[model samples]
Target: MEAAMSTPGRGLTWSLRGRGPADVPVVADPGPWPPDSGGPAATGRGVRVCVVDSGVERDHPAVGRVDGSWVVVKDPDTGETSVRPTETGDSCGHGTACAGIVRRTAPECELHSVRVLGERFSGTGDVLLAGLRWAVEQGFDLVNLSLSTTRDRFARELHELADQAYFARTVIVASAHNTPVESFPWRFASVISVGSHQEDDPGLHLYNPSPPVEFFAPGQNVPVPWLGGATIRTTGNSFATPYITGLCARLLSAHPSMTAFQLKNALYLSAANVRFRSLPSLPAGEASDESSESDEPGELHRSRESPEPPEPRLAAGADGTGN
Candidate 1:
């Protein structure tokens, strides 16, 4: 049996007994579900999970039932675009995969689909921006962004939109590129960025000191729902992103009043195999307010012999248009 204990000085600390990571004091897991979660969290009753991707097939067996759907349509002649209500359907199965994952993670949460990508899994940044902005304004509790833009020109607008979602308390879980390229929105600190990990357990996750990519979940050759009520095994950050989105839905449902900041803290604290060397300590009385942003990549917790420099990784687009 593994034993855990927490110390009440400076910040919360835990010591585990067993062959896990040695007996060194570690940070406590602040996940909403207990370590031994045998079933889904019932708190996801009324929460809303919005997937901003290549539309979702709401009626698909994996996706079950969808509450609402919207698609970004561009006027070919003028290039102007607007979001309009549409029938729930997927373009090429990418969005449906994400929605399916969320459904599997939080079965009771209301699911909404916002289609931004087209048949080729490609779309202009403006359309992506429009879809995301609408979702934030609508006040969805969680938004899943399995796609990103590699263009630098959209950085400013994307950053502003990310911050807007953050301030609005809408948690946007974005995915990092599988390749070594630059991208936007996912790299923004305001959003929860996820990467792939070589694990079979869907509930497993890890925290990385590396910027841009903050967390890692199962993304390797995992089976996911695809087009036309079918299933396929695929690999990419795109698939990995929805896992975190589902988890966020569960957390938000458990704590309906939690702000984005609070939800983020809960994730960080609950991450598996967390390392505290690069994590900053929370100041007294600062854990319950907006100022807690410092706790993320802030001041160092313990003295270091020599910290390894973070490696730069390229960002890739997640249009689900497999190349």
Candidate 2:
């Protein structure tokens, strides 16, 4: 029997036991609820996604039609926070890169940008929380947070917000920190956490039989839009995260009322490595069979190497986690 572990809010997220690449085999059985990424099914027509990063460049061709823009403002004197509309663009190109990935994956999804990181990608932990709270309150279908806080003090607040997003059906797709260090939101079971994979196929993603980081997507040497409508190749878990976010948007667009948990299940079943024991049709707005869902994952096989540390940026650390 495969081993399983439970998480807060989310129960028995992983149903199998495997560590690293060799242990997780690729079974050919198609899962009961296979994730469909066919062209017509998921264009992200009706989904709303909030990119909470440095900020997204307006009309950068790659990231077209940003429906709204907001910034988290902190009172330098009182240290209070508020969210306001902004005409500003990306501060250090990170947010634009993430936003561009989402656009490429799900072209029709409504995109919104909220600037939590400023010039040189410098911002505080409180500011991160404020921006995240605002994004969650907006009821956005998905929030792509490529940044995180390493401070233990901020963990509880981030967890609460993650739970809030989970129960509200506002799925939060967060990136696992580039280093093996501890971080927020992404570590929370209530959120869909992602890490990077070394694969040429952008369409490929795999489920780990382990816990903590749930899925691995494309995040190495990715071609993405940068400042001034320029394109650059970058590598990091940050880039891989939007790949999952884009998928979530597409899934939600197809299944309009899918909760974060349900959407995550579809992602798991859709994973290239998942093997189906029996093909069971899932009712709309429900999870797959008995906690673990599909049988032990063993489908498509690929390189599962842990991504190296992200390339260094010129800025002062990422916005949020103090450098």
Candidate 3:
């Protein structure tokens, strides 16, 4: 299923327009901690990764190895949601692709599948919320949310759930909508928001200085697993999310004590776009003027003294108030 479904407000910008490498400023290096120190031997041996998407085919060759699986069943009459253990297959192959990507990245990480979306690649916000809440409660080390809710009514509830996962040390890696439409869970700063980059290397990803999206990974024309034990080349932010999820599995497996915040910091430091050397600065007068109005659109204008830009502030927590 295409990640960018034709939903309202889907035409928003998802790409950085008219920007080049030279436009990015070089900043001094911050020494790296929570090192991405493990290899395949440390491939998430003790870490757990949960894919909160459509569903993962437990036996597909690409996703041939999964540790466990769960499906969410909702009662239409009563509007109640419950989880039941099942060895189900992918509903639309999207979840299988995500699972395969994560497995490829973190070969040894224990994998769990949660079915929220159905064959049409859609689900209700209530169901999504219920699945997310359960995942947080389970305390999985890393929860991947490739789907998001656009309804404003669920924003507060989803925000609370994201924060709950945040404080519980369950890092939520969510995908930004393929279109620029406003979406929940991913927009919340408590979760690590990811988007697609036009790159082919699965291991490569970049850090976004901009808000709403914090990371970009290979999501275009990528080969991913499909239903029926086959593979196809597809593209979407959905596929890109699992790449980071896999990397997180490796990091968490190596540094068991690292919190979600620390894991994010390590990712920023290790990103390919991160600069270790400081760039030449303009005169103080020129700097002040540049900040007021920039000739280049979308050029990030921050003080050069700081090694990195500040992270986006957390949105209002469960109570509809800022943290």
Candidate 4:
């Protein structure tokens, strides 16, 4: 079954372009209390993040606490439990790397380690379905899916799960799979698809390199604790998805009253667009502008071609509106 699926690749291009070292900035610094200075703070303190992938190491220095966990792998012969702490775990290292990113951004969020992938970093669609059902049952505030499969039916089921999570006030964050071509589930509209960005590059910072990349985060050369006895440096959109997941946790904690749609809009508006020198190498004679006109804060700009969506009416519990 694993052979029928596409193997995940490395160095997938993201919509936002930036060039810099791969180290993600951790939220912890000055004090236990929230600093008056504007900076990333521990806004995920009281939230629960259920990470659905290969199992997590409960003792890693970077992972502060494990509120809950489970293993879903089954035996091939007797249909018995094959998943144990000593057996089915994150040998592939992708899951742990993503979990680390989430931890960095939202240190206070409690992690729920739900192991869907086994020792080989492969699993059947049934395994994934079971994991997500369990996650929903647990009522997590957020769930991070760092794995991908090409099966379209499975992807649809996952989308339904995301919709259920959204209405239940649970956030679902998944990796925009790293491939020569786009992958499903991540490409699905309901899930918050995250793409990787190289930190510090000026050109790609402001614009997206791909569609449905709601946000960008550090994913290249990120150092993360792995299974067994060592830590490794890794890169991919798989690692970047959790950064947004953790960020969502923090944002939710700060504004517990906001809905999921409001939270998503806030992230889109907060992103900084870097000035690109040129439209990225378009086909022959494709006319494009490299510069944008600066507008004053609170100013509205619209093209004459089409009408914009109606502005959302501000509600009592909604966050402030934006462009």
**Candidates' TM-scores?**
0.72, 0.74, 0.74, 0.66
Whole-model Cα lDDT of every candidate shown, in order: 0.74, 0.79, 0.76, 0.62
Q: Please write out the lDDT profile of model 4 over residues 1-323, one tens digit for every residue.
A: 23213443434333335754454443422221223544334357678898888777766676656666678766666654443333344546666666776786777778887888763434467677777767876788888988777776687677777777777777778777777564556666567777778884311212254567566766787677776635787888777778778767776655554556765654544344422122244568966545333333333443222111122221111111111
lDDT of 1 by residue, 1-323 (tens): 01112335533344443546555555532333332454234435678989999898867888888999999887777877789999858878889999988888777789999999883334568888889989998999899999888888888888988887887788899989778889878999999999999988766777787766988888988788888889888888898888888777766655566677766665565566544544435667654544455455645454322221121010000100011
TM-score of 2: 0.74
> What is the clash count of model 4?
13
Better of 1 and 2 by TM-score: 2
Identify the runs in model 2 with alpha carbons over 4 angstroms from their true place.
Answer: 1-40, 119-123, 278-323
- Candidate 2, residues 171-226: lDDT per residue as tens digits? 99999999989989799999999999899887788887896999999999999999
Stretches of candidate 4 off by over 4 Å are: 1-41, 75-89, 119-122, 201-210, 228-230, 274-323
Order of quality (TM-score): 2, 3, 1, 4
Ranking by lDDT: 2, 3, 1, 4
Steric clashes per prediction: 3, 4, 0, 13
Tell me the tens digit of each residue's lDDT in model 3 across 1-323: 12334553554445656887676665532322222432223366688999988889878877767888898888877988898887777888888999999888877788998888772333569888888888888999999888888999999989878887887889999999999899888999999999999976666778999878999989999899898889999988998898888878876665566678877876786666765532336667654443444434554444333333232121101011110
Q: Enumerate residue pairs that collide in model 2.
A: 26-298, 26-299, 27-298, 27-299
